[model samples]
Target: MAWAAWLVLWALWALRGWSCLRCDPGSMQLLQELTGPYLSRQLRGDPGLRERLEALLQRSIEGLAELPIGLPSYMGVIDEKTMGEAAAHFRRAVTRIMENDYKDGQLFNEMMWSLQALRESFTSLMARFQREVFCPNKCGHMVHQFIDCRACRTEIYSCNRGLYCGERRLQVQEDDDLILDCALSWHRASYGAKSYRFYRARGNSEEVMVTSPDAFLLKKEVTANDSGRYRCEMLNTKGWVCSELRFQVTVTPLPGNSTPLPMPPLLGPLTLPPSSHPTPLGGPGDWTVWIIIGSSAGLVLLLIGGCAWLFRRQREVPKEDQDSPGGQLNT
Candidate 1:
């Protein structure tokens, strides 16, 4: 009888673990399908670009596979506001791509499509889960169960009370300092104090105050030496929170510049001096000369007109005297 009881207990524990393990293959498959086309497009231009993209995609896939299923499940359950925050992450990634290049154009369009698909998938999954689990009268909240502390974790929840609600998570980067950003906010009552506790991995890893709850801004400069896992604990006077958020931070040195140096002066095509052909109109002095010439031409035309007028008057007086026949002997 005693053995049977022990067996039943072990079986129950195993079942709990399996339920907490929220791995779904659909997300991984979708991610690959979306990114594969993008990388293939980039590969056509530069063989090196193709190789780099392949490596990056491989690493990303492997990392996602290693992630606890709970992470994606939590992502699936995120509300619209939290989902917006996730969208921003993708936007930032897309923004990192350089513009006006072939790779940039392809990557930008592909990323936008991928993000939209991701958002849609998450919304649909959450809706299905909500229909199955959520109840209006129940006060219980659902959160993503965490398995390890020295790694990344994500949580999603909705309040049954409907008075106060939020979703909080921690993400670790490959650099110094943990990033903790809130995605959703509710009533002032839900805006109480929260704190994140940090622990070292080695022996006597002293507990440190990484963040304190307040309205003040929390900004931590990232460095290469600050890689470690961290856990966040939120607290308020109401009661102890049930959800625990964990993440692993890895620090990587900044990459050095690898751009090729410009070619030597003699090796490149010789650039000729810009053309210095004379303009049709000389300069400011030329304008002055034109003005003087115009004035002289006008004066010459006026003198010619006066001489022609005098000649006409002389001819007219002779004709008048001949017609009158009064000055024949004088002529």
Candidate 2:
């Protein structure tokens, strides 16, 4: 019945523009020729009234189309009062338009049928909404943080403790999977034996979903594309029992070890290269490189020191021999 009614609304929507275009004073006969055969011989509405009602029907279709198909469990709850107002306006318009000769005009009867179809569509959608959406089960206000621990990025769901997902934002290293771990007791207690369906929403489009009878292992191998606001929902068979958590996932690069060293310029006659220039032995940067360069200088210093010590010793021995005559001169 819902499908049939939906089809009727679609047909009405498709024809609404044509009905308006043809209702112009010049194209009355053309409109009659087009729609007169389909509308039964039970409504003979006035021409002006018929035009007004057609316009009203167009407005009705517009309003219905604006409504979201399924009541989003997160935001934009269906407006029952607004829907009722539209239905009432439609009813009053129909009542005023089809006063006396309602059962003799093709156009008037067609309008009435379209109105009924619109009403049915509203009823069906509202019933489904009440059964499923008007009442949602659990959860909200979550921001989870995940750190890349070499192998994987993981975060544990706060087990019925607080509303915030975590203290920090989700940080995932490039090419690691994000794992969301949570205890399932809260949902189990709320939903009882009913099955669960998981839905994830990102940005402003329709949510992508998957179904599981129990707690689903949530692991997403993260990439640059995975950075976004993510909402995870757990819903059950009755649709009344639902739980959701909202969070943001951000991906970052791996840790770096060190920065690259700068290259030395080529040598010239007037200006020597960095290699040709004498470098200080001790410095803050490149200690190991400096030690390698100063090794030869250390050996030369050792040889000069030994020569000076021998010369000093010879001078001291000569002074001692001159002073004492025969102390000792061992070759």
Candidate 3:
């Protein structure tokens, strides 16, 4: 049961990252604890082996997002949602890795779990994940994306198409940030796509995204410079584009001294914030507030005037008038 839950957590985290989670931190801690004990068994003598294994682990985790759940479909036809979607999902992931070019499969084979026994162990863990975690948490048709009680921020993003999350478009104010993901965003794909080039267009000019913090993830705090059309191309082993993901990012200037407009999560990774900027400070529905600030002051002044008028009228009535019936203070 614990291993199954770990599979769900590791896969979800590897795909969505921590931004979408709202649960406790124990999942990661449990994973780290488990990983150390397990790796220690095989990593006792060879000091260099640990480093290589760590790199393999990191790469494998990152690659998990792109590998679709289960193997390729039989035809263009899609399968109905059934009890074994989890198996299909994982089958796709494994098949994608193995089907990739030689280098991709080689890296996977080098991983500690490549051995038949360890591979079966990994498979067993995933099976438990399906029964305990996957089936019970099905919220919608998107089994690969929607995992568990939908523990996400205000939104979620995942791998759906050739790219992890399909296409996207964005228009946000200055100081806003963006994220873009694609097929080549993974470390390994069916094609020997080693790297991707990101490009943005402004009028006739364009700039390639080279120095971004990460190749798979694009964390850019949009400025005036960011406003324009954007595209990312996944190149195959032949150095030609195999897949293309495009976006039109428009960065509007934030008015001086005004609160920067809130930007909700985008369809895909582009919604990622907290690294560039925090996410939404809104609710499920829109709302409006009409504040009347000085109305209370106006009411106080009216009351004071009424009291002053009564006091003046009392003063106007002389003592002699009070003594006379016709000139009574009541008048």
Per-model clash counts, in order, read 1, 9, 9
RMSD of each: 30.3, 22.6, 29.2
Of candidate 2, the 10-residue stretch with the lowest lDDT total is 142-151
Tens digits of per-residue lDDT for model 3 on 151-235?
2222222223333334577777788776666443233313232456788676798787652323454556768786667777655
Tell me the deviation in Å of residue 192 in model 2: 2.8
| CA error at residue 264 for candidate 2, angstroms | 18
lDDT of 2 by residue, 1-331 (tens): 2332443455565433222122133333433432343222232334543344445444543443233334332122333333344345444544444453434334335555655654555456556544543432234222222221121233322213333333224778767887543334344434234444444545566465555664554566677776665544554445543445555678776678347897555664566446665656675457977787799789999999999999999889867777684775768
- State the weakest 10-residue window (summed lDDT) of model 3: 71-80
Better of 1 and 2 by TM-score: 2
Q: What global local distance difference test value does model 3 have?
A: 0.45
**lDDT-sorted candidate list, best first:** 2, 3, 1
Q: For candidate 1, write residues 44-114 as lDDT tens digits.
A: 65656556545554444344333244432432233334334434443444344323244444544544454
TM-score of 2: 0.26
lDDT for residue 46 in candidate 1, whole number 0-100: 63
**lDDT accuracy of residue 329 in candidate 3:** 60
